[model samples]
Structure formats: structure tokens, C-alpha cells
Target chain A: MSQTDIASRLGWVAVDWGTSNLRLWAMDADDGILARAESDLGLNKINDGGFETVLRDLVAGWLPDTLSDDNSISVIVCGMAGAKQGWCEAPYATVPARPETLAAGAVKPVLKQAGLDVHILPGLCQVDDPDVMRGEETQLVGFMADHPDFAGWVCLPGTHSKWARIANGTISGFRTYMSGEVFALLSQQSILRHSMQGADDAAAFENAIRHISVKPKELLHCLFGIRAGGLVSPDGQQAGAGAAILSGYVIGSEIADIMARLGRDESIALIGAGKLASLYRQALHVHDFDAEIIDAESATLGGLRRAHAALTKS
Target chain B: MSQTDIASRLGWVAVDWGTSNLRLWAMDADDGILARAESDLGLNKINDGGFETVLRDLVAGWLPDTLSDDNSISVIVCGMAGAKQGWCEAPYATVPARPETLAAGAVKPVLKQAGLDVHILPGLCQVDDPDVMRGEETQLVGFMADHPDFAGWVCLPGTHSKWARIANGTISGFRTYMSGEVFALLSQQSILRHSMQGADDAAAFENAIRHISVKPKELLHCLFGIRAGGLVSPDGQQAGAGAAILSGYVIGSEIADIMARLGRDESIALIGAGKLASLYRQALHVHDFDAEIIDAESATLGGLRRAHAALTKS
Candidate 1:
């Protein structure tokens, strides 16, 4: 849609602002996306007073000229922008939190910019349980919207991976794993970087997953083995195998931990996309667990749209 | 001792050239230290052809003035400087390798310098096993020399921590854990750094060790708990506790792996010193394992001295 058409049709805006990036979608009354926009100004990049400016700059072209002076466009946001150190603190809604009712716990920060009614959605936290997640709650909520009666484990794999227990339409509990962070630190920053510099090797990855699943205690030993493997592994095969093995060890450990916590009987709903998703799927197959892959982008959009619709209806 | 006295008494030189630093000791026939020297120029710091130059620069003052022209001082070297990428490749002496007999595997490289006969000692490697150690082999040799009848698990803790199975006076097989590297990367490079900055907390460290022992599979989950724990832990306590917990998790996992490989019944000889050694001892106590602490510096010195004596005798 053209900017002019979006300007006229834009009744509300939906956003998913995270640590490193901000994504926005302008929507009409019928839930159609009139226009879409994004900014690299994630919470980490924007100062306390700079959120309003960044948001306005991104959506300024979507405002209709005929709108009255006092009229405001509703904007719904999720993710890190709601954290304590973010634009405005949106205190976490403790679990078991109904995904649909997240809007009730939302906070509306006072904005200097006119013609904008913004509601920042709250993240989820388990008080006594040792887990916390910001933007992932929105994705979980969106996943629930797509499958209302879904009740099982939902795995959101990323920088700090999350595994949530969804019962009915509410999130009962969740756990976070440092798998992605571990993988990144070890592969790129640790001594393993020299050996782990290459494309993925599926067979090596699967072999690692299988090895870790059977002997989880050897995880640390297996990590050092990468360096030794690099030293001994003949020329061309070393780099790719090293990287793939590292990935498998990290991801496999996470899977092993989750299985230990919540048994391996149930199938997991993997809320991820691209290479990471494929890797997780392959890992799950190696561990003998069935997984249904769900695109994270759509889940984020779906959650934001669902939240926006709910807020507008009220 | 004065340079002249050291020069007159020096019969041979002993050096431990590792990845980050080079340590040398001027020794007499009776193993009395004549002089000591060190350099920051480790194998990683120097180029292929630069090893001899750096060694000569460090020990040039120790050469005797009365020595005839073309007479060379025998310098016995150990550690990473003898690796494939170091001064010259010192082929690994595969296990079961007798620590006292490491001199048999020594590789001599012709030096450009006139007054130096440098012999690089080979490190120990378990060819079919997934482990290798360079400098630690010398320490193990010294430890074995000090305890001839000792036959058990010997741990040399550092960046790449090694656990060797010593039988009689020979290293049977061994394994390496990236415990120190994991702790360094997580506490310094990963996001956990912020929470893991302060003086050591003994209580937190022991608590993490005990927790991981019972639930070894929850290792990754406990790692994430550190981040969440940081968020909730009261101010002032977070940093130390986070550091301690990270230390516990990394060290705990290593201990857990080693215990899993070798039963928990056998005692472990911890070849380490300083704060890291103390922490490992505490971790061992928490895990119900008896650890006999040995001074690392003394062990390295002893190993180098023993190797030098053996070479001179041969």
C-alpha cells in the first residue's frame, strides 16, 4: 500500500521493540497491514527520552493530514522497551498469565509527542520460579492466538533461548537457557573460534547431538575436544566439523536439560525460524523428540496484532 | 644471586615456555637455583623463527665469561614452545607415558646462537583418546617423581584443565575440560560479566557446586539462572555471588564429568596454586571428594629441574 493510503487507513500501530531492533506495523480497522516500518533503534540504542523521537520519526509519514488536532492513533508495543531501564517500566505480569489479558497489565508512558496513544505490553515473570523473559511473552501469546487450545511446551530459540509451558491459553511457567549465548561466546570469542570458522556440517552436528544426549556429563570435555579435534583433524574438514560440533554440543545440552526438567514424552512446539530452527529440528530428531516448527516473525506479528485488537476493542 | 655467581654456577637452564609466558631457571648439578628469569614472549606471542632469539635475550646474562668459544650451555625446555606451531615440533609422547622418561621424547633444534644447546621436551597426548596437554606434562612428571607409587587421578587446573590417570609412574590416559576457559569467557566476555564482578564469595561457590552435583543435567539451566539471579539478587551481593556461581557451575561441571568418568570413591590430587586452586579445593569439598593440594609453581620447577637432570645424565 502507498504511504497516502496507509495514512488514511492507519487506525492503529503495532510494534515489537527488542534489544537491538524495532519493528512496526501500521494496521487498518479490518486488521490489514496498511504499511510496515522498522528501525534499528532498539531499547539498547535509544536513551530514556529518545524513544518518543525515534517512534515519531518512523511513523510520521503514516499520519493522515485530515486527522483532528486532539485525535490520537493507538500504538501497541511489546518487548524490551517495557523493561525497567527501557522507555517506561512495564512491570511483568506474573504467571500463570493469560496471554490475551496482557493488555490489562500494560503501562502507558506519558509522551511529549501529540496524536499518539501508546500502550506498552508487559513481559512475563515467574516469581519463585527461576526464569524471566521480555519479548518472548509476546511471541508466546501470538502462538496461543494462532492455536487457542494448544497446551504443551513452546521453545523459542535465540540469543537467550526460552522454553515455556503453555496450558490452554495461558503460560503456566517457563525456563531460559544460555545456549545461544554459550554457542556465540565459544564459537566466536573463545579459542574454538579458529577451528569453528566455516559452514555447517549436518552429519557432524547430528553426531554431536547424539553424543551429548547419551553422555551429558562430558559436555565440558567435548568443548575442549573441539580445539584438539582442530589440531588433529586433517585440513579441509576441520573448520566446518568444529563449528557444527560446537553447535550440536550447545543445543544438545539445552535439549538434555529441558528433557530432564520436563520429561521427553511430550512433543515440543519450536517457535523459531531459518537456520537456527532447522538446527533445533535436527537436534530434536536426534534426541527422538517430535517438534512442530513455527515461524518466530509471524508469531511476533500475530501477538502484537492480537494485543492491538484487544486494546482497541476495549 | 649475583649475575657473575649465577653464571659461574649455572650448569644447565630449565624453561617452561607456555602459551602466554616463558619462565626460565638457571640450575646447578645439585638442582640448586643459580638465577631465575622470565619473559612475556610465549609461543603465541613469538613467530616461528623468533623463539631462539627470545630465549637467548632472556638468558644472555647467565652465560659464563670463562666458558670457551663454541661451548654451548644445555637448556632444557618444556611446554607449548615444543608444540607443532611452536619453536619446533616436539612429537607427542603418547600414553602410557612415563613422566621420568619424557627426556627420551625430547626434540633438539639447532639454534643460531653460539652458546645454547636447546632441547624442547615433548608434551603428553592420548592418541586415540580425546585429550592433550603440553606444559602440564612436565608438572605431571615432577608430581610423579615426588610421588613414585602414586596411581590415581591427577588434576592440573588452568585455562584448559586436564585430568590425567596416572598408573605407577606413567600417565595412562587423560581428559581435558574447558573449565577455566568457560569461566573466563562467561565471567569476562559473556553478558554474565556485569553480574560477575567482585571479590570471591565462598558460600555462593560451594552452593552452586552442591546444586549441580545432584542435578548435573540442569547445568545449562543453572547458567541462565545466574542472569535471572543477577536481576533479583540484592545490590552488592550480585557481583560476588554471580562470579562465585559462574565459578561453581564451570568447576562443578568439570568435577562432575571427571567423577562420572572415574568413580567418586578415588581421591584427586589437585596440582594448582593461588586463588584458583583454593576455589577448586572448596568445590571438591562440597562434592564430597578428597583433594590433596599441591603447589603448581614448585611442581613446574621440580619438573623442569628433573627433565634437565635426566637430559644431562643421558
Candidate 2:
């Protein structure tokens, strides 16, 4: 749709702002995307109290020139934009919280922009267990909306990977792993960087998966082995192959931990996209666990749409 | 000892050249230390073909101004200086190798200095398993000399912690864990740095050790918990406490791996000094394994002494 058409038809805005980037979508009343925009100015990059300006700049083309008083467009945001360190603090809805409860937890940030109803949905927090997740709760709500009876585990793989338990349409508990960050540190910043060149070897990955799964205690030893392996290998073990093995060791450790917690046979709802999702999926398969893949972007939009509908109805 | 006094009495030299620093000891014939010198010029800092000059500069004060043609001082070096990438390549002494045979594996590089006999001792390498250790082999030889009948595990904790199997007065097998490096990276470079301020919390360290030792597979999960814990804790947790916990998890994992390999009952000859050694000793105690503490410095000197004797006699 053209910019004019998008502005005229826009019912609400959906945002998934995170640590590294901001993604915004303009949606019509029918839950169809009228326009889309994004920026690399994630929470970490923006100055203090710059969220409103950043948001306005990115979505300026999608906004109508003027609106009748009280005829404001609803703007719903999920993720770090609602975090304590983001635009404004949106207190977390502690689990066990239902998908329907996310809208109630949403806080409307008072913005300088007139004729714009902005709501930032709160993330989920578990006090006694000491775990907090932002942005992911929206995805969970959307996942539950689709599979209302998914009384099992949901895995969202990312920089700080989260694994949440859904029981009777409510989140009971969850855990996070620093697998992605650890992988980056080892491959790009640590001494292991010398031995790896981002090569992807399927065989090396599979072997590491099998080995680490059986002996997770040997993780650090196995990590050093990668350097030793590369140093000793006649051809230096193709960098891609070395990287694949490193990823396997990292992602494999995460899989092993989750399986140890939630058991091996239970199927998981894998919510991720691109290379990360594929890796998680492969890791799940290696452990003989069935995984139902869900595109993270779609889940985010569906989640925001669900929240938006609930707010309008209320 | 005064410099002049040490130079007059100096019989030979012992040098431990590693990745981060260089330590040279002027020793009398009986292995009595006459004087010592050190430089930050480790393998990683010196330019290509600069090891000879760097060495000579550090120990120049001890070298006699006018020596007879055959009155050169014997300078024995160990550690990364012998690695493939270090000063001069000293091929590994593949196991099962005896302590008395290290001198045979030592390589002499012709240097510009006239009155310096330099012998670089080779590290140990396991071809089939792809493991390598440079300087620690010297420490191992020294450790064996102090306790010739000791046959069990010897752990040298540092950047790349090592666990070797000692039997029949020789190194049968060994393994290295990147625990120290991982700890440094996570506590200083990774996101966990925010939560860990390099604090030394005894309680936190002990608690994490006990917990991780029982369920080592929970390491990644526990690591994420550190971040979550800091985020949720009203005080953000004492940086020291967080760092101590991080250290515990890393070292505890290493202990768990070594215990798994060697069986929990066998005692370990812990060859380390100061903070790292104490940490490992504490971890070993927590795991209910007896650890006989050995001074790392003495072990290095002893190993070099043993090698020098073997070379001169042969």
C-alpha cells in the first residue's frame, strides 16, 4: 500500500523493540500490515528519554497529518521499549499469568505526540526463581492464542535464550541460558577465535552434539579441545567446520540443560527464526525431541495484534 | 642477593616463558636461586625473532663480560616459548614420556650471544586425542621429582587449567580445561560483567560450587541465573558476590570434569599458587577429594633443574 493509504487505514502500530534494534509495523483494523519500518536504534543505542523521538522519526511517514480530537491511532509496543531501562518502566506480570492478562498489564506511556494512544505491554517475571523476560511474553501470549492448550515447553533462542513452561493457558515457570552470548564471546572474542573462521561443518556439529549431550560436565574441556583440534589438524580443520563445532558445543549445552530440566521426550514449541532457529531445531532433533517451529516475527505481530484487540474491546 | 654477587656465583639459568610474561632465574649449580628477573615481554608481545634479544636483555646483568670459549652459561627455557608459534619450535615430547627424558626433547637454537647455551624444552602432545601442553610439562616434571612415588592426578590451574594422569613416574595422559579463560571472559568481557564486579564472596562461591558439582549440566542455566538474579535483586547483588559465584561455577565445572575422569576418591597433587590454587583447593575439598598442595614456582624450578641435570649428564 502507498504511504497515504497506509496512514488512512492504520488502526494501530505494533512494535518489537529489543536491545539491538527496533521493528515497527502499521496495521489495519483487519490485523493486516499496512506499512512497516525498522531502525538499528535499539534500547542500548538511544539516549536517555529518546524513545518517543526515535519512534516518531521511524514511523513519521505512516502517521496521518492530523486527527479529530479523541480519534487517535492506538500504538501497542512489546519488548525492551517497556523495560525498566527502556522508554518507560512497565512492571512485569508475575507468572502464572494468562495470555489475556498481558493487556491488563500494559502501561500507556504519556507521549508528547498528540492523537497517539501508546501502550507498552509488561514482560513476565518470576520472583522466587529470579528470572525476568521482556518482549518474549508477547510471543508466548500469541503462541498460546494459536495453541490455546499448549501445556508444554516453549523455547525462544536468542542472545539470552528463554525456555518457558505453558500449562493450562498460563505460564508456570521459565529459564534463560546465556548460550548465544557465550557462543559469540568464544568464537569472536576469545582465544578460540584463532582456531575458528565461521565454517559450518554438519559432521563436526553432530559429533559435538552427541558428545556434549552424554558428558555435559566435560564442557570446558571440550571447548579447549576445539583449539587443540584445530591446532593439530593438518589442514587446520576448515574454519567453517570449527565454528560449526563451536556452535554445536554451545547450543548443544543449552539443549542438554533444557532436556535435563524438562525431560527428553517432551515436544517443544521452538519460537525463533533464521540461523538461530535452525540450530535449535537441529539440536532438538539430535536429542530425539519433537519440535514445532514457529516464526518469531509472525508470533510477535500476532501477539501485538491480540493485545491491541483486547485493549480496544475493553 | 646483590646483582654483582649473584652474577659472580650464577652457575646456570632457569626461565619460564609463557603467553603473558617471562621469568628468568639465575641459579647456582645446586639449583640455589642467586637472583631473579622478569619482563612483561611474553610470547604474545614480542615481535618475530625478538625472543633472543628479549631474553638476553632480561638476563644480561648475570652474564659474565669475558667468558672462555667453552665457559658459556647454560640457559634452559620452558613453556610457550617452545610452542609452534613461540620463539623457536621445540617439537612435543609425545607421551607416554618420562620426566628424565625431557632434555632429549629440548631444542637448542643458535643465538647471536656468544656465551649463552639456550635449550628450549618441548611441550607434551597427544596426537590421537589432540591435546597439547607447554610449560605445565615442566611443572609436572618438577612435581614428579618432589614426589617420585606419587601417581595420581596433578591439576595446574591458570588461564588454561590442566589435569594430568601421573603413573609410574611419567605422564600417561592429560586434559586441559578452558575454565580460567572462560571465567575471565565471562566476568570481564561478557554481559555477566555487569553483575560480576570481580568480588570475592566466600559464601556465594561455596554455594555455587556445591550446587554445580551435583548437577553440572545446570551450568549454562545457572550462568543465566546470575544475570537474572542481579536484575531482580534490589541491590543488584554485590559485584564481588556475583564474581565469586561466577568463579565457583567455572572452577566447579572443571573439578566436576576431572573428578568424573579420574574417579572421585583419588587425591590430586594441586600445583598452583595464590588465588587460583586456593580456589581449586577449595573446590577439591568441596567435592570431598583430598588435594596435596605444591608450590607452582618450586615445581617449575624443580622441573627445570631436573631437565638441566639430565642434559648435562647426557
Candidate 3:
């Protein structure tokens, strides 16, 4: 049976699971959208075991009328499912993976109470470096499906941002940004989290972009001052929450630094959540570069679907 | 039984063992000068049961008159010996620790083949943070001992650099800098590493320093461009090395930014391998700051002695 028959016969299922967030998609038999659901049921949410319970609870309402043992539910997954502790650990796919190169991914028999025949998509890995991509790889696959001709750097910005170098319809190389992690650390763990007192002020955020561009070198320096500023400056300017300052420092620095390296390119594609995507757009706009903000949900679903289709045929 | 008497009668016998470096100090009873012996036989060298032999080999002629059971020899150790995998696990001394805090570190139960009472000093741990310190803390302790009146920020630059806030006579607080580790990655791992055509030059380092202080805000931008300058720029005046450019960009930006928060009167102390120390001294000095450079060996030795005295007396 093909994806068309499968989609028309059963509900179109799509799951976008990432490091910190999990998004689920439910579509009618015609692949038409029925309803969308999202939960904090991210992989990082409840260790490893809780995924099954959480996933079941989130999708229980969408379960079809009658299910047979042989006729297992056809679903594809992306994101950290390929990680060491995800649903079914998928091995990394080497670079230059073609469209048909996509597979069910390396599978691991996870301890399961329910028999959910799930095929987690494998993220592309840069063997030469430490960078890895699971969910975004599916997104890239979707992008490929949409525009086979599109190439150059496809950027997916988030807590852990990803930069992919696409050439000749192949992902030649990619790099992961610790931007998200850095942001979290600075905002919460590190002293910089405290310096970020005025988070609500969008102006501070914009101004940070400008300041960071002009003084990108101050990134690391600003990090040290989150606490030092509180001690030496008595006005309490640095005494507030550090996240506000750290967010500015890290995000602003990332913009300036990444922009400088990427050059004044209009080729970069922006994909991520609300504030992060907006901030990225604003940063690019400041430099007079055009960035197309891709629908994050669409990207994940499209990517997941392509992987789903690819796996069904095999 | 006192250290003073044991030293007077024993001649020059000092031991410095760390993660990857070991040294033996031979001095007179009055702590006057004597021969110094060093070897690469560090704690890391003896994976299992061999540190004792390595030390003995390094100090071939420095052994006691007769390895008698009743007449035990006294030796003090400072560094990773307290670490889980070190020669002996000395454990950690919590905050508010004084020069004598780790003085009573437990002696290694295992006997050296020749039989010696080896005392390992406890490492230091911060009260508020999880960052722990080992050999470097002892080195910092030694610095405090030498400059009893010294108070302020002590910035010891190295692979894992440390910055401690010293008030009056006590080390009130301290933080570590991944500066060295970061530099190594930028220079050796990153794309920028490839662009730098040559070894680090004083002029280049100084130039980068000037750039950082000039703007202080564009530091990250400076870091990002080191790689692109070679690829995108027309003149590519950033000739020679991307690595060196990156190094300069990183080091210069680090100094400018970190120093901006520090008040003029704040004292900065540096401890590291000679070259790293010299480079840091020059970087900070050119920024119109004075720093005191200490001998790594002496500092380690002093720390060991201080801890030895503390533990034995306690």
C-alpha cells in the first residue's frame, strides 16, 4: 500500500519531536488538516520511559475505530528519536544522503508496553565534527521536496541552532550552534541571566542587535560582567535578572558573529519558534538581508511525512 | 617530627605531581635553594600502579639514607592526587577554606614501594557553585601566602584559567575561564583555524587587542570574520593565518571585555606555563594593566608546603 492509500485510509499522522519541545499533527484520510496538538511532552520532558505514556495520552483521542494486530499504525518520527535514548535510537546518516537515501533509520528495540510500530528518522551527522541533526534533517528533506533547486546555507535557529550547507541537492556539510544552550545557560544558570532585567522591553532586544553588530567582540566580555557589574556598579543596573542581559549578549553576539561569517547573504532560510525566529529576522533585516521565515510546523510535518513515505515503501 | 626538623635533616626533597606534570624539589633545611628535578611522569602517566616507581626514577639520587621502616620520610603532594583517578583520592575542601583548609588531607594508604608517607592536599570547592579546583587552587593559595596583603581579582590564565575575588587575606570567591580550551578549539578545530597562515606573532596579538578595546562591542563579529576574511574579502589583508587571526581575535577580545568590568585598582595575577603566562602578561599589559607572574613550580610547591603544615599541625 502506498502513502496515498495509507493517508486516505487512515489518519495522517505527523510528529515533530525536538530536544525540548514535541509537536504532533493529525490529518484526515485525504491528508487534509483535521486538528493540531502540541504538548510539553518533549523527549527532555520525562526522561525516556514517559515518552510512551505521554505520547499515548496526547494521541489517544485521535485513535481510529478498529485496529488490527497485523495492520500496525503507520507513523514516522523525527528529532532526538535517533539520539542515544530516544524512542528507537537511529544511527546517524552520513552526508550526501540522497532523497531515496532516507531509510527507517537504525532501530533499537526500546522497552515498550504498547506495540506502536514507529520508525524514527535518522538525523544527518557530520562525522568530521560534533554536529548532529534529527528533526531538522526531516525539515531539510521537506525543503528538498519543495524546492529541489534551492541550495546554499539553510539555517534552523533554536536553542541548538543548525546551519546546513546544501549543494547539488546534497547536504555537503552542516554545523550546530550552541546558541540555544548558551542562551539558556546565560539566561538561567550563569550570572548573565540576572543582568537581563528588562526582558519585556523589545527595544532592548533590538538595540542589543545593533550594539552586538557594532561590538561583537564584547560577547565573552559581557559574560564575565553579569556578576562583576553587580558588585562594582552600585546603581543596581546590573543587579536585576541576568537572562535579560545574557539573552541580549548571546543572541546579539550570535547575530553579529554568524552574519559576519555568512556575509551579506540573502540566501539564509530562517526556521524556529516565535521570539527566536523574530529576533533572527530582525537581525537579518538590520543588515538589509532578506530571510524567509518558514512555517516551523509545516517544515517538521513535511519533513516527517517525506520520511514516513520513504519508510512505508521499504 | 616537625616539618622544620625533618626538612633540616633531610636536605632537598619536594614533590609536585599533577594531571600531566611532575617535579621534585630538593632544598636545604632553611628552605634555601637546591637542585630541581622534573619529569613527564605525572599522575596521569601512571594509569594504575606505577606512580611510585616513576617518582623514584625521577629523583634517582634524592632518596633517603636508608629506607628504614621506623625512620619514615615526609612528602607533600598537591594536585589531582585527590581526584577520583589520581594517585590517591584526597577529596575536596569546601568554601571558607583557608590556607590550612586542605592541610589535613588524608594520606595515601597504599605504600610507595620504598615506603614513604605521601600526603595529598584536598582540592577546593565553591560554596555557591559546583566548580571545583585542584592544583590551581593550591597555586592560588600559594600566591595569597606570598602576597599576604594582596587583595582583589587574581586572574590566572591557562587551559582552565581561574579568576578569584580575593579580599584582605582570604579567597572570597573564584570562577574558571575556558579561555584556553576555547582558544585551542578556535585555533585548531574551527574553520578559522585553517585560514590563519602562520604561528602567533606579538604584533598580530597586539593588533587584535587594539581592535577589541577600540569597539569592545564587535568582539564576536571580529571572531566570526577571521575565517571569512580569507575567503570573501578582496584584499584579504588578513594574510598568513586564520588561526592566528582567530587567536588574536579571541585573546584580544577576551582581555578587552574582561578588563572593562574590572576597576583600575583591581590586581590581576597570572600563573601558567611560561609562554602562556608571557603572552597573557603582554596582552593585559598593553591594555594598560599590570599583572604579577609567578613560577608555576614554586607556587605548586608552596601550596603543598602550606597544606602539609596545616594537615600535620591539625
Interface CA RMSD of each prediction in angstroms: 1.6, 1.3, 9.8
True contacts kept of each: 0.66, 0.81, 0.16
Answer with 2 or 3, whichever has the higher TM-score: 2
Compute each candidate's TM-score over C-alphas.
0.96, 0.95, 0.54
In the range A205-278, model 2's lDDT, one tens digit per residue, is 88888889899888998998888876666465533577888889888988887787774444589998888898
Q: For model 2 chain B, where is the 10-residue window of minimal lDDT?
A: B231-240
Q: Provide the TM-score of chain B versus the true chain B for each model in turn.
A: 0.93, 0.93, 0.84
On residues B17-60, what C-alpha lDDT tens digit does candidate 1 reach at each position? 98999899898868878878888998878986999889888888
* Per-residue lDDT of model 3, residues A198-304, tens digit only: 44555545665676677665555446555545534436544453455556666676666556556333277776768778877766776677777787777777676
DockQ, each predicted model: 0.68, 0.77, 0.09
Could you give the DockQ of candidate 1? Answer: 0.68
Cα lDDT tens digits, model 1, A81-197, are 998889899988888999666878889989885689899999987756456888899999889888887767899999888999887688888988889999999888888888876
TM-score of chain A of each: 0.94, 0.94, 0.78
Docking class of 1: medium
Best model number under DockQ: 2
Ranking by lDDT: 2, 1, 3
